[model samples]
Target: MRENSFEHYYTQKPSSSLETREVTIRLKNGNVYRFISPSGAFSFGKVDKASRLLVEYAEVEENDRVLDLGCGYGLIGITIKKEHPDITLFMSDINERALKYAKINARDNNITAEMRQGHLYEPWQGYEFDVILCNPPMAAGKKVWQEIVNKAPSFLPSGGKLEIVAFHNKGGSRLEKTMKEVFGNVRTTIKSGGIRVYVSLKF
Candidate 1:
């Protein structure tokens, strides 16, 4: 169904306004991109802080299949492909507008990637990845957050890293426990910047 407006496609479903705005992100490499922003989507005006860090430190290897969960506008996926040039990318988002922009940015950046619109992994069922880079939507509340984490592990291969970054106050500690349940080890990197990146391997 074509959504009327971005009433947080994740939360409510649709809005009346249907207004579109321009959201620009300045990447770490000084590359700037502007995309049509749908109202009521997460971080509708700017690049989210936690996601900024995810793209900042995202690492890729040749031919690695990378998944960008909650990939708003394809920033993480596009950036990774630009830097690495050989990694495969798959972008998924709940917001239809976000997914639209992801495709737009991918075209603008000349990156070939598979775009999937689904709640977490519904689109990639039975598919495995070498890396999963996600800035999860913790603001959606606990149940939703757990849904994302619980389902993310099945997509990762053994020794593959599930790179997740989130706002420090938004149940960051709690996520570590969930990570441990799926993966034996959960390492936190950059815990001092009001954000944390939890790197977990599915053993």
Candidate 2:
């Protein structure tokens, strides 16, 4: 069974057995994060495996402005800021509770992130990101998924990267095609279990 099902993950306040659990995450690249699990982010979470994989593989440069789109509990944004220190960080989520958790997590981790509230990239209408990392909500259905692909490019500066991790079963192939149409090139950077990470540049 999927521990973090969309039904459970979609709720702003999750009342799951996994709720209130805390997990210590030590990144391979030498950052440590203590995350409050089932905090409307991941079930049984130290770090969701996909998230761990994304951070592990992607190179986070110092001073790069990053957007953690669909930030959940702010694990990704806070971790990047804490590690690099100089990188600009922004996090956004449609669920208000998710944003609340992100802020709490940031404070708990002693990291600062500009928090935005909106679906996907709506909060940053005119600005561009140096790097955007997303673990998109495929279960939000086709229209929502479509919007994510369609709008992702607008958030990037010329040559900026959009990186996404998605389950292999969740129309990830379709997403790849859509990303190519939007960004001109899309390629898989890594794959493990049923998740694949795709990176593309906007130019």
Candidate 3:
């Protein structure tokens, strides 16, 4: 495929060269995870800072049904399952290479998760989640990211939450505004690195 293009990771069948690497991420809670990332996935060589922050702060309960939208190599969802095994986790992405590694990572970690391949909420049409986590693909542009923010409510029940991380200069402000407009309430937790975690509750 196009080398390092934004659309490379969103392709259903990625044509990028098959190169793989293994990465270990140590979570804030001292839990460690190992993942296999291939060339055609986002953050292929390491765990992304935004995704790391999302997993660190995204609130999840023991029995919460969680959906990791656009889960690249299953970092967010797999980490959650590792911490709270009782929570049901679902991971979806459009990249086949990412999905393949996600399944492998989950299996290697001995974590149970449903991995589906589809764009944003399409594969999860009939499913509902108690918590949704995303580190949206900002390179995909505002319309794509905003669609993720806007469509989250329909998949969530009352009291359910949607949490996302974005760079302040890279659509975080717009995301906050969209969350406020869509969910009626939005809370932000900011980091010194200009990364903002936006949380919205469906009520």
Q: Which candidate is the best by TM-score?
A: 3
Task: Quote each prediction's TM-score.
Answer: 0.86, 0.87, 0.95
| Stretches of model 1 off by over 4 angstroms after superposition | 1-13, 16-24, 27-35
The RMSD of every model to the true structure, in order and in angstroms, is 3.9, 2.6, 1.8
Best prediction by lDDT = 3
Q: Is candidate 1 or candidate 3 better by lDDT?
A: 3
Instruction: Please provide, for model 3 over 21-57, each residue's C-alpha lDDT reduced to its tens digit, 9 standing for 90 to 100.
Output: 9888897677788898899888888888888888888
Over 4 Å off, model 3 = 1-4
For residues 1-203, write the lDDT of model 1, one tens digit per residue. 22332235564344535566666668768977666656656666567678778877765689999998878777777877887888988888877767876787788778899998878888899899999998877656678778777877788787688888886676888987888886778888676478988888777
How do these models rank on TM-score, best leading?
Answer: 3, 2, 1
How far out, in Å, is residue 73 in model 3? 0.6
The lDDT of model 2 is 0.77
Pairs that collide in candidate 1 are none
**Model 2 per-residue lDDT tens digits across residues 1-203:** 34357756665555644455666768876667887654455434556788877776765687888999888877777777877899999899876666777788888888888898776777898888889898777777777767877887778778789888888777788888888998889989999998999898887
Between candidates 2 and 3, the one scoring higher on TM-score is: 3
TM-score between model 3 and native: 0.95
